[model samples]
Target chain A: MGQKLTPGDSRSNLYNPQLGMTLIVKTVTRWVKGFIFLFGVYIVLYGHLTPGGGFAGGVIIAGAFILLTLAFGKEAALERMSKTVASEFDSLGALMFLMLAWLGLYFGGPFFVNFIQRNLPGKRFHLFSAGNIPLCNIAIGIKVGTSLFMVFIILSVLRVVVKKGERRMVQMKRRGE
Target chain B: MVTLLTVLLFFMVVGAIIAVETKDLLSSIICVGAVGFGVSIAFLFLRAPDIAITQVVVEVLVLVILIRATISRDVTAISGDREFFSMTVSIALLLVIFIFGLEVFKSFPQFREPVFTTMSDASTNTYIQRGLIQTGAANLVTSIILDYRAYDTLGEATVLFTAILGALAILRAKARKRTTDSSEGNSDQ
Candidate 1:
């Protein structure tokens, strides 16, 4: 989905109309979004010991992407990154998580066995603790981010292409040379 | 019983109105989404999550395709007045279809219990005893889905493969791109 949507700002495409937005407002939005995204990351990382997991945290990060895209124009958002690349990253992330789970078998254990163990030298209630919860969260975050990024990118690209074609035709008609 | 159904019916109607009347293409798409969601909720209150999910996902795909198609239309090319009459007639036919659809609901039995929960129970119990002894997983859904029902997963994967193949077939182009607006034409060209 993301592969279909991401467009480059070449001679055929658009420029960022919202980059000139006020610094204070933009700064605040970015800061808030960044913090929320980071907190979501924390949620996924410690999922084994905590209530939040990969899915919850992934959605939070997606929300942050949405905020960043809205604050800047779609072109600026795409300028910083490609949707195709993000989708590939998402697929790779899921693959790694499953691969790690299966890798447990090679270590003389069952699939998805919680092999790595470290204690706070105490109980099972620390953020730095939890065996493989963090790993699961990372997978979820990637899946969610890619899905949402695809949805938004598809909508934005479709809109931009139509607008660009219209503008081009109008410009050609007006030149009358 | 009647009141709840009536309220849902009314909501769908209003949503349809808003979707038709809206000027901005985005607003109309949103209204279409809202109408689909409203119907999904009604399907839920009718006690079917699977149905709700199906409707919502399909509707999302449809609305996205429609919005893209509409945007690609040459907006400057206005049609004749007869097109409006044709639209009204088609819409009236749609309302008649809706009336018949509601009547068809009487044929299905009311939700006594979720069929899957009961069906899943027999499979789940077997897996529970076998999984502990065989697979070491306590979660019945996971055990059944991954280990016991590996064949089903294979089938599901095959289904996904078929879908991707179909998409690839449609997306593939042999001729040079003639600058058609579709993503397929763009990429192939």
Candidate 2:
């Protein structure tokens, strides 16, 4: 829906037809998105040591992306994160999480066992001391973030067309139709 | 503390009622979010920070989804007769549930101390004591979820994966159907 302007279109650079909000809003979003993303990463990494974990962090990460989309329009946002890339990351995250769980089985323990060394000398509450928990959190964070973002993107692309006074919701064309 | 909890609960209930009764979809969604925030605060006050964090994030995600879903649609109010009937049924159901809940609450013994203290098994005590030593994590909730009950966490993750996959599949199918229909129309034309 947002792919109307060609690269060589004169208006492409001058007026971003894909521009979502006012200049002030976009400027605020540009400043905030990075910090929000970093906070999400921090939450995921420190999940074992802190209250926030994969799901919460992932949602926050998705929130940052959503904010970007809201501020910069779908085309600009998709340049940063396309649907295919998001879908692939979602699958990759889920697979990585599953593989970690299977690793426990491969090591002759039950499924999802904390196989890595948990008790390292003088490493208590340290970031790297969680024995696969951090890895799991990262995987879950990626999966949840991408999935939620995908959901938002997909839903936003559904255009409600009122043709001849009959309302219909249709998936917007990849290129403007 | 009790007064604080009571106030939060009152607000939560009011928010929930507003969410259900509101004609505007966006306002209803926001009201629901307010209720969720109140619940999260209650969870924190009850010493369940992990749950509170998850609840708040989930609430926000849900709010975003709801907003996106309704953004382009016309805000059509429910018909008066249907709305009145639904409201009547809902209020009646709520009254019945409240009465039953009060009866149940009365049946339970009064707690002189904390509810966890009254328990005979002391599972909470055991988890608190052994959680750090066994799991090597400072957060008890993390230790329980990722270390002690890792399998349960795995199952929950799998459930989440399945749900997302299902949603993606459905949405993709709809898109495919639309494309094929348009293509057929073009060929006919």
By DockQ, the best candidate is 2
Off by over 4 Å in 1: A1-28, A42-57, A74-88, A104-134, A150-177, B1-9, B20-24, B33-113, B116-189
lDDT of candidate 2 over A82-126, digit per residue (tens): 999998998898889889889888877888777774324236788
Measured against the true two-chain complex, the DockQ scores of the candidates, in the order shown, are 0.10, 0.40
Candidate 1 lDDT by residue in tens digits, B86-161: 9899989999999999899777555554444556566555655655444433333333433455345335434533
TM-scores of all predicted structures: 0.50, 0.83
Q: In angstroms, how far off is B51's CA in candidate 2?
A: 3.2
Docking class of 1: incorrect
